[model samples]
Target: MTDALSPAARLALDEAFERDAARGGFAHRGAVAVIGDDALAAAARERFGSPIRLFHELTPIPVAPPEGCERHGLVPELVDGVTLVVGELPRTLAGVDEIAGLVARHADADVLVVLAAREKNLERGMNERPRDSFLEVAASRGRDKARALIASGPRPTPSPAYPRSEIVSGLDFPIAAHGAVFAGTRLDIGTRALLEVLPAQLDAAALPERPTVVDLGCGTGVLAVWTARHLPGARVIATDRSWSAVSSASRTAQLAGVADRVDTVHADAGEGIPDRSVDVVLLNPPFHDGRAVIDDMAHPLFRAAGRMLRPGGTLLTVYNSHLKHRGALERSVGPTSQVARTPKFTVTRSIAR
Candidate 1:
């Protein structure tokens, strides 16, 4: 279903399914686990001949849970004595960390199999991260730049390393992150660049009174925490689709001593926020949709910002320079102006019309 899945992934999926089917269906194997939304679970169901337990980064969120499957939020321990099928979807370091954390948490799982595109850095991650939790990890030869990793024999000691915290150089407070949050605890270069310019831009005396700021896609709440610290009078809302991110953001805000000023929400975009109710929106839009590197992912975010901002409100964004989001910003929000630029990133201010 996801066109972004590489040919190698398709082959790996077929192999995994056939392996299970030959061994007599996943239902017979005990419990079955699959991460992410329905598309991936659907693919697994087609071959496994059974319902799958769905694990989501966020809980009680808008996305519907798979039918007849137990739903869990951010808890890998909920799945055990099962075969976990991981689709090659997450493309970032944080995503890899999250999956590895899941494996570590569910060390008792009968088998952990990954279908990943070999050309990506997935092989390295697959080989390394599982070693923390499993006694044996092996990989299949590459096929069409796709590979399969099978890990078993859960290690008894060494607890899961996740929800880690690190202090970044540019910020005053430490950032806490879960595996699913983008960039994990590390401050991404694009976000770091945006943070450098945010203080001056947000501090401008001409800003509206008691502004409501929304951090769209607030991975780990770096922007929200920083905004709350600098703009003391402003109300900050940090939102992300990942429940892990939402939880991590909340912790970051609290750790930064701004919990009273910031609100963390599990949401896709700024979903329930009132129309024209926000004054400023900070964004570091994701570049990929599943595994495909596409600029179209930011279009909806831009439109959401446009819908939430009042006339003359501002949307500050940082993105990969090569993405060239200027045209889309102009069309979706309003006229756009460059705020800052580095070798790899571009920061812009788009005003809502």
Candidate 2:
């Protein structure tokens, strides 16, 4: 299967591992953990010929695993006794820290982690994050516009600091966030804009006494928990593709005392939610795919919302004004109208056909 990985990046990472192994760095018989996708995982299996464990966070469509490999869905135990980890480096510093902490806290004592990304995305802070969890951290020479970070000698770090909780101003509930969760514990401007106009839109929309609400691409369950608290009779479903996001959302709902009313689902754009089953969908779709800005990133979510909304059901979305998503919403969901706008954002309401 074709992967999103850059070939040069993957090759540089592989070369790093080979060089380390030649120097007797990888001597343990412990398991191999591949943290992102099949690209590096496949390479590890080829080199080690061992049963590898795979973990994915942001990848929506994971390729089939190699022989003797199994997918582990963020279970820390799967990382236990792992001597080597290979994968793409995450985009955020928190993500880098989390990976470092995970390996230090669970993997074998001599675990070696090789994380690679395109040279343009590398930062000095990425190197420092692993130092908090590993004794030795270094960067390989850049090759073919790609570089790899090598970390070894796990340190005794305190308990995991992820799924961080914080209370924000103007919000009643606390936001819990894992390392890779978007916007961290603070509300983004787009979501804030959407929330500003959401109440009036809900009041104007004709709906049942107990509406089924969905928060598509829910980051920290802010919208879902808010909906549940605002509408006592409503049942809210919050879904996101990232495991960290789903975990954060679940923790947010629990901390907000709305766990009974809010359900957290780890999915891609509300996938597995029945068609025409939801009364309303609150969406603040992401415009970035990794580090690249892609305006059509929300198209799948728009179509997903269209399928999940019942006839005449409403979709409330807030996005950067420059994206001009009104045309996409109208074509994907149904008739659309703007509800509110800020200097940077625009909130729109769409009615399903």
In model 2, the runs with Cα more than 4 Å from the true position are 1-5, 23-28, 59-65, 158-160
* TM-score for each predicted model, relative to the true structure: 0.81, 0.92
Model 1: colliding residue pairs? 57-243, 58-243
Please tell me which predicted candidate would have the highest TM-score against the true structure: 2
lDDT of 2 by residue, 23-126 (tens): 68554575688877666666666666667888878553344666777777555765788877777788888888888888888898867788887777876688
Compared with the true structure, model 1 gives a TM-score of 0.81
Model 1: CA > 4 A from native: 1-30, 43-51, 56-62, 80-89, 92-94, 107-125, 141-145, 205-209, 288-297, 321-324
Error of 2 at 9 (Å): 5.7
Global lDDT scores for all candidate models? 0.76, 0.83
lDDT per residue (tens digit) for residues 1-353 in model 1: 64544565566566676666665656656555666556656665665666677665644445666565666665655465466565553555556656665666663446756545556656345466666767777776778876766666666663456678889788899999887677788898888889889878886525766889999999899999998998898999998877888889998998899999999888788888999999999999999855679977888999999999999899999999999999999999999999999889999999999
